[model samples]
Target: MKPIVVTGGTGSLGRRVVRELLDAGREVVVLSRRARPVADGSRFVSVDLRTGDGLDQALTGVDTVVHCASTLTGGDEQAARTLIDAAKRAGVTHLVYISIVGIDRIPLPYYRTKLAVERQLEASGLGYTILRATQFHELVQHIFSLLGRSPIVPVPTMRFQPVDTRDVAGRLAELALGEPAGRVPDFGGPEVRDAKSLARAYLTATGRRRLLVPVRVPGRIMAGFRRGENLVGDRFDGEWTFEQFLAEHATRRPSRFTDAGGSGG
Candidate 1:
């Protein structure tokens, strides 16, 4: 089996992909800005994509490149260019890109960058598969944390179909092993839940009591989320619900209570 190169292998999804690939008996090389040990017999190489530093060394002799590295604020195009050039130079057979669902519909800065990366991959002339997935379950937790403590969890009035990161990783590994097929079907969570409902579920599982207040933000990005722009196709397939995810982690900790008089804690 050819060695598979995984960018951002230290990240949540990237690490899972590396594990799946290695479990299938494929050689794995992790490319990141820092060297870190992984569990699946994968080797690590330090390469900063922002400065295009050490990319050549990472790409050398790599068979399939699964690009999981991305910037949320800026520099997406430059990073894509560097990775594509290095892959082409190294004669990489396939380039598998992991992207977010509904990037085109969302007006957020991160989503815009994701869309640009997708275009670059399509035009790169390398056999590629762009797998667009819905928000991960962990992402929702992060969002809730960022919102801070509040009596009422003010969720964006939108629908979400959050998938588990492991399922997305499995799909990416399978795509890497097969031929590139351009943009594949969108991968989404098993069920659709409103943002406020999901937040309430998180609170309940965590033993935190809070009211869910759905609000509409005055912006294109919020509008898109409200319209379910981040959702996958109607026919998309996956099996992981927010409830199941909450149940898995509910018993791990005690629930913290906060007053509704101020922001959530």
Candidate 2:
């Protein structure tokens, strides 16, 4: 069997997906723009998705491609287009993509680009599976950390169903192992929670005491969040809860916060 190529294999979710595939005893190739240390189970292939530099070569003889790479500085569409072209030339069997839930309802520019990428992937004629997930627990904690910079943290009057990245990785690995299924059921956390409560929980977990000021952020994005656009109440596909996630990361990030990404999931 040919190897599975994973774009952004060094990224937060991509790395986890690589681990899952490796544990499943599948050959994995981790593609990155620059060289990264790879002494583990997977092979590292340096390739650029934007300029198409080395992308075609790395994708050679690959059966599946799990596209986990995303751009915050823009050029996401270009990278996806470049990758699709390369995958077609390589005769890749399946292309799995990760997306966010309720991107269509939210009017954020980043969300718009994500939706556009989903459509582009669908029309690419490649066997593709799209997994739309909710906000990540790490990302939510990161937001609270930023808001908690001052003595009074302004908590948004919104709700979010944040899933664990580990769970998302497992789901993506399962989808990659299976045949193409377009836009599978949206994945979310076990509970749908308001931001204020989550913020308090985060503060307590991080051992910080700050006045949580519940502020109503007026905007289409906030309105969408308030309406739980970032949530999938019908089904909760994730196994880890926000509290469990916090427990694991309680020591990792005690003072500072790192963004999972600009967008959720």
Candidate 3:
């Protein structure tokens, strides 16, 4: 099998996917925007998806490319289009894209970009597999940690199904190694919890005290989350829960948390 190239291999999900592929004894190449160290047996190549620089060289001998590179900021569509073009020219046999669940139903900026990327992959002539998953536990933790700083945490009255990044990475690795399937079943967490409940759980796990203010956020995106548009009803495929994830990573809590909202990914 030709080596698999993982875009954004330094990111939370991409890094985990790279590790999984290497563990399976498959030749893996880590593609990133900047130079970074990778797993002992894996290769690393600096590739900027924004400009397509180094992308062609990175994909030269790569038969499969797992696209985990995404940004909460803009330019995701351009990046996806550029990647599809480069992958086609590089003779890639299969392209696996990791996407977010409910991007079609949600109207958030990030979701819009992800949805557009999905369409681009669908229209691309190259063989592709698109796997959409719920938000990761780490993302939720970041959001909560941000809000936890204040005396009263204002949590939007929304719902979430936070899956583990490791689980998503495993699925991506499997898809990278398998035949391309257009779009598979959406992956979700074991249980769906409201934002307030998740916030309380996080505070309790991290040994913090804060009044959680559940406010009705007025927006189509929040409305979509309230309507369970971000949830997968029949596909509760992940094993890790929010509580377990908190317990496992509680020791790495930052002394100061940022005051930013959670990302839509």
Candidate 4:
């Protein structure tokens, strides 16, 4: 069988997806801008998603692609277009994409770009699946660490559901292995928590103490978060909780967190 190519395979979520795919005994390829040593069972191919350099050659003989690659800056739609075109030429069957929840409700530029990419993939005429997941546990931890640096941590007066990357990875791996399912059910964390509460949890978990202050910024972006547009209500697919995640990690580092793809949420 042909390999399933995973973009941004070195990222936090991408790495786990690659591992999950490998564990399922599927041939895998890691496509990135730079050549890196991937897992033993998978091969890494250097390709620039921006300029489309080396993408065609790497995608040859590939039938499925898990697009964990993304950017907060501009150019995501262009990159997806390049990949879509290349996938079409390669005769790729399924293109699995990871996206964040609430892109439709959020007015953030990055979210708009993600939404655009989704539409692009849907129109690409290739079989595709899009998985929109809540923010990752590591990302939440990273946010807290940044805020907790000072004695008083002023967190945004908003709420979120933090899902574990492994859970999302396992689901993505399963999707990659199966037939394409367009826009499957949203994956979310076990509970919905406010940013202030999450900050407190981070302080408690990391053995740090800080005064939590909730700051309500006036903006559409903040409004979107406050409205819980980013959260998945009642339906939780993640098995792990935020508290469980903090217990497993002795130290939470920004390097361990990723905003790449929708996993950066």
Following a full C-alpha superposition, what root-mean-square deviation does model 2 have from the true structure? 5.0
| TM values, all candidates | 0.91, 0.93, 0.93, 0.92
Give lDDT tens digits, candidate 1, residues 1-265.
6789999999988999999999989999898887777755899988888787888887888779999987666787898898998899999979999999989988888888899999998888999999999999988877775553665667777788889888899999999999988999989888787776677667767777665566778888888888888997584566777778778755433555552423331
Q: Write the per-residue lDDT of candidate 2 for residues 9-67, one digit (tens) a residue.
A: 99878899999999999999999876776538899988888999988889989989999
Across 74-135, the per-residue lDDT of candidate 3 in tens digits comes to: 78888888898999899998999988889999898889888889999889988999999998
lDDT of all the models against the reference? Answer: 0.82, 0.87, 0.87, 0.87
Count: clashes, candidate 3: 0
Flag the better candidate by TM-score, 1 or 2.
2
Best by lDDT: 4
lDDT of 4 by residue, 182-221 (tens): 9998999889988877776677777776666668889999
Per-model RMSD to reference: 3.3, 5.0, 4.5, 5.9
The TM-score of candidate 2 is 0.93
